[model samples]
Target: MSGPHAPAQREHGPLPFALPRVTATQRRRAAALLAALEAHYPDAHCELEYRNPHELLVATILSAQATDVGVNKATPALFAAFPTPADYAASSPEQIEAYIRSIGLFRNKARAIHAAMKDIAEKFGGRVPRTMDELLTLRGVARKTANVVLGNAFGINVGFVVDTHVERLAKRFGLAPADATVAMTERWLMALFPRDRWCDVSHMLIWHGRRACKARLPACADHPVCRGFGSTCELRISARASDTDRTKSNQKPGSASRAAKRR
Candidate 1:
C-alpha cells in the first residue's frame, strides 16, 4: 500500500494487520480512553530512576531486555561509580560492567554506555543532547530512548515511546494495527492524541499496562476504559477460553465418564 493512508511496512514485508480508518467517533472514543487512563493514574510518570538525562539514557538502554526495577537496583551503584558523562567516558567496559552486572546483557550494555558517553563527552560537550537527531547519533539510542530522554529530561515531546506494554495496549484498545511495529504504533499514537498530551499519554498507558493490562492476564473487567468500550475485553476472554480448553484437553480421557458413573 502506498498513499496518505498506506500502512507502514517492515523491511521483510507488510505488517500482518491493517489499522482501521480513523473517524470522528473513533477519535471521541480514543479521547475518552485517554481521559479515563489519566484519571486512573493521576500520578503517572516515568518509572525508571534517573537523576539526569545521561542516567535516563543509560537506564533506558539497559532496559532493552530488563525490567525497570532491575535497572533501578543496578543504577545507584553504577551512578555513584560514574557520576558524570565524563566519568563514564573515562571508564573501561570492564569497570562499567562491574557496576551493572546484575542487569541483563550487562556486558553489551556497558559497552553501549561507554560508547554513548564517549560521544557525549567528545561530540556534545559532556552533556546529553536535547534533540532527537543528536541523541540518535549516540550508540544504542533509538526513537524510544530519545523520546524517553527528550520528554522526561528535556520536556520536549518529539514522539511517543512504544515499549512492549505500549505496543500491546495500543492494539488491545484498537488504537493501532494489531501487527504494527513499534515505530508504526508510535506514529499511530501521535496521530490519535494531541501533541501536548503525547508525553502523558505514554506514561498513562505504561502505568495502566503495569497495573491492569498485564501481558498474560489483563484486569479489564475492572478497568474503566475497558468497561466503557462495551466489549467483553477480547484479549482476556480469548485467553480464558484458551486456558479452559487446554485444561479440558489435559484431563484423563475417561475421567468424566468415570465421574458420571460414580454419581
Candidate 2:
C-alpha cells in the first residue's frame, strides 16, 4: 500500500494525460459509458454480503486476492463465531485463522482482522470509523478497502473502488491508459463520473467486467456498449485477435488432424 492518501502506482511510468486536464469529449464519452453500464446492470452493487460495517470491512480485507464468492463462503462461519469487534479482539489470531483459512493469505489476513478489530474495540469504541483518515488507520485498510467500506456500508462516495475488474474495464473502455495504476484509474474515474455516482460507477464497471468484458474471452462481439464503441474498443479488437491466434494455433497440422479423428 502507498501513503494513505496517495494513489498506488505500478512500476510503469506516469499516466499519459494528467487527470485534472481531462477534455470535454472524454467526459461526454465517460458519461455515455456510465449510462450504458447502468442500463446493463440496473442493480449493480457490491457483491460482498455483509450485514453491517464491521462485516463489510472484514470481508473487503479478505477479498484482497480472493474472489467475492470465496470470501462469502468463509464469512458466514467466521462472522457467526465472532459477531462483534470486541469478540474478534478477544480471540487469538490462530483462532480467527481457523475460520478463514480457506481464504488466500489467511495468516496475514487473520493478523490484520484481529489487529483491526482490537483497534476498533479499544480505539473507536467498538464501531468502524466513518472517515477516510480514520479508516486508513485500521490494519489492511487501504484506500480501496476504505472506499468499499465507506461507499457500500455508509453511503459515502469518497472515491472509486479500483479492484482488478474495475481497472481492466476502465482500460478497455479507454477511460484510462492500459498501464495506469489502480490509484490513477480511480482518479480518472472520479474526475470522469459524477460525485454522487462514484460508488455506483465502480459497481457498474465491475459488473460489466464480470458479466461481459471479462479478462479473457470477453463477450465483445455481442456486448451492447462494447459493440457501440465498435473498432474503438481496444478490448474487443484484442479479443478478436486472440481468438484468431487461438484458431490458427489449433489448426496446426497434427493438432487439427488429431482433434478431427477424436471428434
Candidate 3:
C-alpha cells in the first residue's frame, strides 16, 4: 500500500476529487478501510474469467443476477463457440441462449450479448469500447459493467463499482450515508479515494464482502477491519446462531440443509 500504486496523498487538505458533501474525516476513514482491505485480501481481483475484452464483456453480461462461479462454469463452451464478436454477431440470440441456458436470465442475457456484440461488430469495429459513455451504448452494459470493463480490461479507473457487496460494505462501514443510492454510493467512494486506486478499491471491497462481510452474515467478529469499522454486528451474529440452532434441531443430522447457512 505504500509504493508506486499507493493511494494519492492529500492528508493536509480536502481531497481534490471529493464531492461537496464529503468531509476530510470521511476521507480519512475511507483510507483506513482501503488499507484494511489491502491488509486482509491483498490479491483481490475481478473473478470473472476472460481471455479478451469481448469475452470479459460477455462474461459480465452473463453475470447479471448470476454468480461468478456459475458464469465461469458456462463460459468455456460459449467462448469456444463464439471466439470473437463477429462470431456472436453472425449468430442469432437463440443460438447464444443454447450455450448459456444454465445461467440465470439466460434469454435476456443472450439478447444483451447478441445486441452488444452486434454493436461492437458494426459500430466499434469488433472491439469493446473503452469509455463509459461508449460502453453504455451497448446493451446490458450499465455503470457497474462499464466500471468492470474499464478497470479490468483496459486498465482505466473512472469510477468505483457499486455492486451488492460494495453497497453492503459501504453502508456497514459508513463509507456512504445509510440512505445512499447506487449512484450516490459510487460518487461517495470515488470522492473518498484517488482516481488511480479506484479499481483496486472496488476489488478489495468486493473480496472482503465475499470472504467475510457477507450480506446475510459476516464471519469477522475478530477481524481487524470489522473492529476498526466500529461494527455493531453482534446482534446479527447472535440472530444467525439462533437460527442455525433452530435449523439443526428441526432437520435431521447429515441432511442436505446441514451445510446451508440461515440465509
Candidate 4:
C-alpha cells in the first residue's frame, strides 16, 4: 500500500488504448520511487562526458546503440579532431568515421553527425539549437536526443528523456503501465514527476537501471533499492519467466496446443 515498492497500477482504457490516464495511487508510487532513487543515488548524473553543447550533441549521436562508456572512449580524439560545428561541417564523413571507428554504426553515425553539424554551422551560426523544433530539424536529432541536449546543455525541461533504461524501468517501477509505448511512457513520466525534476528523473532512473535493475540477471536479491523496493521485482520476474516459458514452448520438439493447431 506504501513505499517505493507499491502495487502495480492497474490500467484501464478503451478497446484500442492510446495513453491511459495516470491513477492517483500510481502518482503516489512515482513520488516515492523518485525519493528512494534520489536517496540511493545522490550523485546520479549524465554519464556521457562532454565539454560543450556540440560535444554533448556529438556524444549523444554516437551513443545510439552504443554504451556511454564506449562513446566516451572514442570521443576524446574525435572531439579534438573536430572541435566545432564548422569543423565537423568542413570535414567529410569518412574523416569523422576514422576517429569513431570503435563505436557501433560508426559509418551511419558519421554521416548523421556530418549532416547535423553542417545544418548547425550553415543555418544556426555554428551553435547547437536550444529549441526542440530546431533540434529536431537536424539529422540524428529525435525527441530523445533533443530532450537530452535541451535538458543537459541548457536548463530546459520541455519533456522527459526516455532511453532504453528509462523505458524498461518506467514499466517495472509502475510509473508507466506495462503496455505503454515509449511515447506514452514519456507522457506518463512527465505527468507523474514534477516538471522541473524531469532531467534529474532521467539520470536517476538510468543510474538505477544500470546499477541494480539491469535487463538480464538483475540485482533484486540484496541491492538496497531492490530490498527496499521489492514489489515490482516479482512482476518483472514473472513477466520474464512467462516470456521464457513461451519461447521454450515454441521451440520444443513436439508441443502443440489447440490455439496453435486452430491457427
lDDT of 4 by residue, 1-263 (tens): 11122122222222223334677887787788888999988877788988888888999999999999999899999989999999999999999999999999999999999999999999999999978889999999999999888777776777789999999888877677789989999988888887678888898899988988888888766677666656376566778999988888777565556448888
* Count of steric clashes across candidates, in order: 0, 0, 0, 0
lDDT score, candidate 4, position 28? 84
Better of 2 and 4 by lDDT: 4
Residue-wise C-alpha lDDT for candidate 1, range 1-263, written one tens digit per residue: 00112122112223234443578887898899888887888877888887777888898999998999999899899989999999988889899999888888889988999999999999999889977778999998988988877777766767878898889888888888778888788878877887667777888888888888778677877777767764345556978999999978988999878888999
Off by over 4 Å in 4: 1-21, 230-233, 236-263
Scored by Cα lDDT, where does model 2 land?
0.82
Tens-digit lDDT string for candidate 2 (59-154)? 999999999999999999999999999999999999999999899999999999999999999999999997888999999999999988877776
lDDT of 2 at 44: 76
Candidate 3: pairs in clash: none
- Model 3 gets an lDDT of 0.82
| Deviation from native of the Cα of residue 84 in model 3, angstroms | 0.6
| Candidate 4 TM-score to native | 0.81
Q: Model 2: which ten-residue window has the lowest total lDDT?
A: 1-10
- lDDT against the true structure, per candidate, is 0.80, 0.82, 0.82, 0.83
Regions more than 4 Å wrong, model 1: 1-21, 230-263
Q: What TM-score does each of the candidates earn?
A: 0.82, 0.82, 0.82, 0.81
